[model samples]
Target: METKLKVGDKVTCDKFASLTHNFVGSIEKIYENSAVVEILEHHKDDTVVVSDFHNRAVVALNHMKKISA
Candidate 1:
């Protein structure tokens, strides 16, 4: 299902590698099925791997969810 996401919304999404469990960021831009999330925090684990994604990434709307305060 597609979610209606707006800019500046805090969300949690996954990354390709880097042993991180989840990536926290605010929506920077929105597309048809994806949005650009400006990563603010990256929670990493013990395993390490080089990832292509940096400060921001185009994440699918379904893959992202609202962050509960």
Candidate 2:
């Protein structure tokens, strides 16, 4: 389902790795079919090592769920 997301709204996003299945962050910006999620917290997934990767990522809107109103 298409969950309406807004900037600064807390949300959890689905990732490729099971361990990182739900990463928490806030919406930074919205695009056509996706939004930019600023990674704030997540499970320590060894398989998907993202130690050096940027915190911000563009994820599909369908892959995200609002955690806060």
Candidate 3:
């Protein structure tokens, strides 16, 4: 089933394409194919990922899994 996501929802994003590691964030905006995520947590070793993206990332819906409260 498709995961229903909305703004402010916490999610875990899978590593894909140019991303080197998985990350956790909250959805800031949603688009047809992707959503803008405001990075909240990530692996300490992947600090560069957060810095490079400036703590924001546009991730595809398929790559995101909603975190249950």
Best candidate (score: TM-score): 3
For each candidate, give its TM-score against the true structure: 0.71, 0.76, 0.86
User: Lowest-lDDT window of 10 residues in candidate 1?
Assistant: 45-54
Residue-by-residue lDDT tens digits, candidate 1, 1-69: 654578989998876544457778899998998999887777655123324455677888888898842
- Model 3 lDDT per residue over 1-69, tens place: 286899999999997655678989999999998999998888887787688889999999998899952
Worst 10-residue stretch by lDDT in candidate 2?
45-54
In angstroms, the error of model 2 at 47 is: 10
- The residue pairs that clash in candidate 2, if any, are none
TM-score of model 2 (CA atoms): 0.76
* Candidate 3 Cα deviation (angstroms), residue 55: 0.2
Question: What is candidate 1's local distance difference test score?
Answer: 0.73
RMSD of each: 3.5, 2.8, 1.6
Q: How accurate locally, in lDDT, is each candidate? A: 0.73, 0.76, 0.86
Give the C-alpha miss distance for residue 18 in model 1, angstroms: 5.5
Model 3, residue 45: C-alpha shift (Å): 1.6
Model 2 residue 37 distance off true place after TM-score fit, in angstroms: 0.6
